[model samples]
Target: MNLIKTAFCLIILICSSIPVWSQTTGKIVDTDRQPVEGATVVMQLPDSTYLGAAISAADGTFSLEPMADRYLLIVQHLFYQSQVVKGQTRDAGIIVLEPKEHSLAEVVVEGERPLVTVEQGKLSYDISAISKKHIVNNAYEAICKLPGVQDRSGKLSLIGAKDVTVILNGKASTLTQEQLIEMLKNTSASQVQTAEVMYNTPPEYHVRGAAINIVTAKAADNTLQSELSATYSNQYFGSYSGNVNFLLTKGKSSLNVSYNPGYSHIMTVMDLASMHQYDGQVYDITQRQKINTKGWKHNIYAEYGYQINEDNALSVGYNGALSGNGKGTIDVNGNFQNSHNDKVQDSWLHNVFARYSSGFGLDLGVDYTDYSMNDYNHLESELTGHTRQLLDYTSDQKIRKVSVYADQSHSLANDWTLKYGVRYDYTDNRNSQLFNQTEGKDNVDNSSSRLYEQIANLYAGFDKEFANGLYLSLSATGEYYSIGNYHKWSLYPQASLSYSPSEKHTFMLGVSSEKEYPTYWDMQTSTTYMNAYEEIQTIEGLRPANVYSVNANYLFLQKYMLSLFYERIDDYFTMEMYQAKDRLALVYRTQNWNYYQSFGMSANIPFSIGNWLSSQVNATVVNDRNRCDHFWDIPFDRNKWACMLSMQNHFSVGSQLGFDLDAMYRSSMISGISDTKPVFMVNVGAQWNFLKDKASLSLNCSDLFDTMRMKVKNRYAGQHIDLNMGQYSRTVSVKLVYRFGGSITKEKREVDSSRFGH
Candidate 1:
């Protein structure tokens, strides 16, 4: 009976699209015969639904996908006119889009609703500090409050996407967890404009999933602005920092200069543990370790752009940061194994890039990073009753690469276009660790090392549009793989289609393949560090993981909108136990040998209440399956489920005063790290204009509920401290901003000498 049912289902699928092949198929191009990148060609059906569509590629070329129903073809681009090829299925051939200058809108909303940027039916968010309200003294402490967002240490899960990538501007910012936070700590919210959070990237973006693009103020306004800021925060200790930014622009040429001076103090407490059996009673022992740390982070950036004759332009950009770290530790008991660990780390990076634009544009640049860390460990173990100190060594290294890429766009014909480009980056690194605490004659070197291929992604794509309101696009990306001693290559493919039958209805389907490497922290060997117990314990890194993603969605309703979407993944990466095996003292040894799979659904609904409030509700559910060959020692199960529900309310009372509120609730990881239950979180912020736009007051209460807490349990026992782990915190901030340079021709930007938090 099961085989019969399966056979019937297969027969139904084979017949579902049999009639679609009878439709006409052709390529779309512009007057120059160039393919327009992301240009959408759509075909409208009788039911007011877009049944088929395509996008143009680098060469201003596009392909038409056959549909099963009759429809009207439509084509459109960023600065182009909407071309409608109104007709029956017989007319579903070539879609030619014309270029139309569309820069007249005074205010461009960067949200994924398509108010700004090209809309190929994918969601996008721009992560910028320009317009974002900076909550004094915190970054992730603020970021976690974002809707459908959560951060555990350095890992950020956006809309429940564990394999997400956080990008600044348009490229990657490879800063460590703490460094990344420190960098954000100095950036003021006033410098941000909009952040586009995109779940599915179009063919043009050669990056990872769920991108947050922070867009700063651009030259479109022709205004010059600058500001300086400083901040002080008290948690474990009082910390202070400073930042300065100078921007200048006139017509199409712009120049920017900035420097950030970060001086800070930190103190943290940790707990450790071990287990023992006495008199048939199993007990866990504990230990405590304390560290008082001091550090400094310095950064510099200079960038300039010239319009050099309309058709040709150029830009030169450079940025770099240097940091110094030092720490001191103290032991309380005679057991030195539970004593303070002393250490220091110094790191710096610099990069330069020059971009040229002409008939075909080119991007040329290079970047270098230098990093090093050294530590001193003191051991006081009862087993040996020996007190000794050992000096450990970590030889961190780095190298930069010269990269060159080009983007070419040409006008193909009426509504058809094509576009393409490629980028290359070279990298080199050398890192190792050593300990000299034992006898000089025999010291163990537990660190494994290697040096090999460092390169940028080689990618390309093609797109096409149909005047019938139908569009289709194809993209191929070459991925980069680097590990301790292994290097491999993979091809990522992407295909998408958008169809709209009427002005207010749209549908989309897409599929793709991609890969992600474990961060240094995830792949690092057991890092020799003194825990609260003062013992030299190792925190091994999780190995690199791979993924395959698929998604489908639809949008409609002239005024009321409702859409549904789903995404599935394979071989997801996370941490799990191996063989459920262990010994006393946990002489720990584990590999990055964990795997899982997951699926999720998302829905968005928007409603208006009278003329005062604009509100929207979004809900999502994700289920993950842990498929490790053996769950063994792992305490958590292979199945996890998490759901998130959010509500966004925008208030409008005249124009001087406005507010935005977002609230969220989430369930445990369906296919996540461990077993965590549900929790509630909220974020509220408001912006008020005073003195007729001369001054503004922004108030924000992030983590309003302060319910953001994460907890983990340790399995072993130590001498002095117990391993009790979790992180919970909250922040409250308010800012008063006033504008100075107006009617007067803008001069070189002047950094605001003093501000509470930059």
Candidate 2:
């Protein structure tokens, strides 16, 4: 009886001694009333040894369990100013944040590729921090060195994938893959803001194999600045390049302009050696050759911006480029045969864009692009002696688009919030082509078509975090798309869940569905290319493919991360062409009779041997198969897998000195007669900066270890026939730059990728 009395007395005493504490529950919402999920909330500690932190949910609600005492709370997110609340002693009070103004300037994400990995299916790369080091001569080379990316033709292969589309500010580019590569090759890296590698694209990106958004710099703030750069390279011959930029700002108005010009005289002599075996017998062959190509290009761009009000702004931009025709001749002396070929291509671009935005989370934009090109080809064989024929072709193309979008959010409960958004897009395109034969023959006109494409999207999502160190989110989306022969309405459902058992340990998994539409070339019968033999046909006009995919992504902490994806396509379209004529055909057609399933896995792992340096290896492997009418393997199917492995060295000298190096080993491949042959290739580079980081220099060497190889095999004729080619594949490049640009905002900010529709 006495012991019980003593226990009761002790409990009463402790309760009386404790101070009163208040618990609050509230939600965080943006100006548009949309919930701000994943925003970090921090409670400052008066004592030096402790800190408390929590993250918000998708619905925008958060809770504060009574603190020992209430202190200032700090809230922050990317593209938003930090928000603080005082006298908030352990009580839930609703908090709101204003969106920060943004410049189109590309954003630079930071982190050494060797030391970073996706821990929760979240993948990222920093462009801003990457340009600070002289890793390559220009942005062109720098992108080629991106982690998980392969350089088959330097521009065609991005992240080990092909048929990727590059965009500027979420808009389709006026330049083709080949032209884009040329422009960046002669441009400086200093102009780059950031490059994002969006591997697991959301639902909207299903139409593309990959997307690379190039974010350039916006006009300077209120300060005025200018920058200039020059580059010269001595390899196989020589080349020169120069660039100038100007910026001005007054109050809410800012303007920026850039001019770039380049000239090159590339002449090379090459001797290729190879050996072939047939029935235990060996034959040695050699190709002796010479080539010279020279040309010049100019790029110009100007942009003006005005802040209509605190929550509204207007901007306009114009871009144009003039380029000289490239002249090149290839001479080959192989075995007992001699050959020569002349090539020329003409190109130009004209583009204009405008946009308006309101602080209410509304955006309206319009864009126009005009593009034209011409090509001429001539060839001569010693056995025949004179020129046989000349092929001429020209194309004029135009594209225009307009878009309207709005978004909003609301708070539900403590650690919970809701988000919603809608978007409408309209695009129109037209293209025409002309073809001429050698002797003033009747010219042929390729087909031309004009059509408008419309797309709409809507989504609602919820997010919340738990006091037990757990977070969860659920979202649903509906999208509609319609185009020429391709039309589809799909309901894409996506969900994400995560758990943080502790600070150093976390786990996440997500699932989503997507639909891909046929490209213009795939959907039109006229866009395909054909050779001398009509038997070799390239078909066009394909249908949309519906894909249901489940993603399993995990990051085993800071040292390792991995993502596994499996997808089943309900209706996949593939282009099959007959091979009977020229090495490269210009006309092709398409058919849709095949369905396929593909499974892939990609990973990034980091390891360190002491403090000397750090390294990372990343690779992707996918297996997919379908049917084709051109080649006779089997009506059943043929399966192929592709893989890539890479090694990187960060900070060659030391940490503070800043340096980067990357080398890759991709698997050898064989795909009918058109697939490219694989060979070991390596690139090495170094750079330095002086004069208060205003002046920089960089040098790079490509294909220094081995020759770039491509062998296209022929499946016809009794003779073992194929075209094996090589040239002066090694190249050296250099770059120098000086900048005094408008006041670039130097703030730590974060971006919510989920802000875009699922």
Candidate 3:
């Protein structure tokens, strides 16, 4: 207890000793007396040394801390003339900017606008500038075009970072990854103002890792907006998806609604060859498996916001996802075994949230989520020198979660900003598996399990800016986790420093620590059969991992970026295949590793050829090592080197026609006891606009050469396996979009349900 008291006193002393500065306040408006939102406001010295920056809110009000008694204030907007003023501890009241007299065609040809800018602790991308040069249709597509961001399958991640959390309008989102991706797909690109990427997130964001914040344009008073779009794709089968969105603002109240529906049919095939040596016998087995599935999905969202006064606001929202009648069939053919299986699944997810914010830097929020899933499976198989076998089972899972948080920020004397927050989360999960028929020798049994978890977190941080164009931020979080009989307390500390001496060069360094928990389904004791010879099982006593990471980045010319990163994780876990020692069965399970480490470097280079073509290239090289001293009965240590390359090109003919070509390649890599082969893929797309820029048609083709198949080989003390996995990777898609309404904007809030489902 004495040590704790000493640490607390040290923190208080450090915070009180920092210097303070005076506050600068201002407002911006257009020539028509209408407020201008999303304007950039900056404070600097007479010699052009950067001090601080902020964005104008919906009411055209902004505040900044200026360490010096005298400074210059600069205001800039997209469609208006820049304005500058000299001030000292005073408010600049009602500054007006004149609209530029330029046509849309002329605006597209202006080459002076920069695509990206380096701010205090983030990299900001101008979405409007990028849209003018590319054929971007939605928020998801625009994010894919950002430098150093990679799109693997349908998921997005930074090139040299760990997990990424996406937020909207500076608010944390609680939706699952799949739900968030769908929402971004349905959102129109015109509503986005800027995208900010942060390597080490600040404490005010209420998140603990790297993040991407999407800032949307604010709506005009007393306006209504709506949009409709449809898509069709063919990849050995037909699929359809459509969305509708509406927004309304009147007086002090705003309402937003959106709906999306989709239907798909998919097919995949895999081949496996295994050499099993058990009980002094060696058996060679080969099998081919095919799976066909069809499903229907629907998503709905609604939100309402009320502004009680200039300094207070309230918002409430609901989001839901429903899918049912999903059916699948599997067929297997092998030299020693033959099997057929049928399965059906249904699921539902619901989330509700509310938030309240005050002008005095106080924010309070609450969220709740409920999720459920049901599955049924039946299998029939025949084995060589054995009788026919049958197996049937049903599984059900349910989860409920609740979260509450409060945050506060204070502006101190000089130029110090202090922030602190506290949050609590509780989760309850129930799972059951029942067997109806069993005809063959079985090692699995009917099981039921219930789990309860709780987490409490408290964090505080400070930010400071120096007169030499340098910025620094530091934060620390204490967390307590309780699950069943496991209880532990951990501390996570983060720090970042950035320097921008000039417009042509910027450098940043960051260090962070976090903890990652496994999925709920992976911890339950259960067995699932895929065929007569293969099965999957879940184990007990799985623990979360602790991750520590460091990264450094350099930007030159505002278009090229270089990054170096290193990371180490303790108690890492992943899935691996093992040969049963007493039988001719193969098992797949998730197990823990002692440690994992990696070091990597990446580069992003962008260029253009006149006004007709623009292109970007990305390359990364990484070395990974894994160690385990007690993995099953065979322990080993492995290391390997891997590399990746990708390029994206865009071609524009005039202002209404555009084309896009992209390609990616990945070298061979190793994971645990497996070695994967190389992969390559190419994609093409085209877009055309008509009807006074209100209608658009687009065509896209992916994996043109069908070269995305994956092959793996695993060889160890007594395990030998070769697997080939192929899916419907090649597809042709066409989309149509039409817009007719007032300017559109959307505000979204979500509940975290990532750990609620299988």
Candidate 4:
């Protein structure tokens, strides 16, 4: 309690000590009298000395703090001519910009404009610059083209950052990563205006660590738009997916809806060899397994927004996903074990949310999510000495979550801003496991458990922009967590500082602290079987991990970046295969480690050749160390150094055809007691635009050399295991997209369901 009070007091004192300054405000409009959003407004001295800058809001309004009584105001936009005005008072009034004339003839441009810039202590990338040189069909593709951004197997992360949260229009979202990615796939690339990346997030966003905010273009009133797309992919099996997105705006109301449906057939194989030492005896085990899964999934989203007035607005939305008729089969054959299993599974998730915002910087919102999953499995196994065993079981799990939040922001004197918020979350989870048949002395039993968890959070922050191109932000959060008979309180503090001396150089530094909790099912006392020789079990009395991170970044010429980072996690938990001391079984269980530490450095460089080829190269080197003194009966310490390199190239042939090639390589790494071999992968894609740029066709091939396979070896304290894992990593896919009607823009919403399932 004393620490929390001291932190808050420090922030208040710092904010109150800054001297007040006069402000400059203005509005921008195009020749058609339409509000010009996303225009750059700069306040500068007569000799071009920079003072400050602001981006025009949705209503074309802007505000900036200027130190001088007389200054020069400049407004610039991409499709318009620049405007300059001499200002002496606080108000600059409305300014109009004329449209730039364009040639109708076909011509090829030989040079590219700068696409990256530093604004308001964040890295901003112009989507228009990318769209002019690359063929991007959706927002997700455009985001992938940004520097230092990486996409691995449908998951997105920023280079040198631990975790990334994605939001839309600078608003907080409750969606999980998977759901947010799906929604971005359905959004049209033309609707994206810009994307901002923040290393140290603000308190008003209600998210910690790094974040990516995607800003979309606003639609004109009384406009309707729609887009339809279909995709087909083939790996070892075949898959099909299709989606439709629609948007409508009239007067003061807007409606957006999207639907996506997919069917997939997936197959995977694994080979394992183990040498076990138990009871002063040595035993050798070898096994090969194959699995096949087929399923149909559907995703739906709908949102409605109403403008009650210029000062107040209301919005509501629903998001859901359902899986139907999912079936799978597993077959295993080994020297000491042979098993065959059949399984059925089904799952669904639904989320609903409503929010209200006022011009006074007050926001109120509520969200609810419900999720359920059911699984049934039957297995028959033959062990050593011709012993046979049979097992059948059914499992069901359900989760319900509710959250509410209120946020307020105040524009203080000078260029300072203060924001505060409070939020509460409640979750209920229920899980049951039933056994129908068991034979040959089963090692697992039927069980049921129910868990209730609650979290309350309070946060406050202050931000200031100095006249000399320096920016600073400080924030602190107090949290109270409760589960069953356990209760705890924690404090998290974050700080960030940035300085830009000129257009050619920018520097940033950030420090943050946060906590991550274990999943619901991982904390329960449950057991599951994979084969006769292997089983999965859960432990009780698990604690959440605390993470502390520091990051520093430098950007040069808006095209190159160098970053350094260090992270430490206490009580880190992970799943590891342990040799049972009392039996001949290999158990996979989640256990907490003493600590995990990592330090890394990364660099990104982008270049172009002859206006036809653009390429980006990224490289990272990291050292990881792990220590645990009381792990089962054997204690060990491990450390390793790893390196990663990736390159992306885009080639354009005329105005309609484009080609892309991307490749990545990772050196060997160690986790727990396992050491993994190196991995390399390459992907190629081609796109063609037709029908006056309204339709596009693309072809892509991933894992061109089929080298993305994992080979792991675990050899420690007289326990040895060799595992080779492979999946349908190589795939060939084709996609077709068509757009019609007027221009469209839509917002995205997410639910808090990342830990809802097993």
Per-model TM against the reference: 0.68, 0.67, 0.86, 0.86
Candidates, ranked, TM-score: 3, 4, 1, 2
* Ranking 1 against 2 by TM-score, winner: 1
**What is the lDDT of every predicted structure here?**
0.50, 0.54, 0.81, 0.81
* Local accuracy of candidate 3 as per-residue lDDT tens digits, 58-103: 4465556556888888999887889998886656667787776656
lDDT for model 2, on a 0 to 1 scale?
Answer: 0.54
Q: Give candidate 4 misplaced runs (Cα > 4 Å).
A: 1-76, 79-112, 131-136
lDDT of 1 by residue, 432-519 (tens): 5655454321234556443443545766666677877777777777766654465667777777787877766767666666665543
Q: State candidate 3's TM-score.
A: 0.86
Q: Model 4: per-residue lDDT, tens digit, 123-179?
A: 898886676566566788888888778776678888766667787887765555776
Better of 1 and 4 by TM-score: 4
Give the CA lDDT, 0 to 100, for residue 436 in model 1. Answer: 49
Whole-model lDDT, model 3: 0.81
lDDT of 4: 0.81
Clashes of 1: 126
Q: Indicate whether candidate 1 or candidate 2 has the larger lDDT.
A: 2
Q: Residues 1-758, candidate 2, lDDT per residue (tens digit)?
A: 37435733654454344332333345577786655655677766544223455555434555444455646667897756689776444555678887776455687443323223332223344443444333554567656545555556545464423345555544444455555676566445544555654433332322233456555544323344466778887666888988766555555776656667778777666554433334554445455667777888777666778898879988888776666587777676666336566767566666677767678645565555555445454544442233233334444445455555555656777968676767676766555545544332223346556667788888777777777656666667788888866677767777666666764555666665555655443344343121121112324445677666655655565347666766666666554333223221212234554566667787777665554455667887877555444333223345668776777665545432445566676564434323435556666776776654556677767777646655544232211234455556677777777765321321101111111100
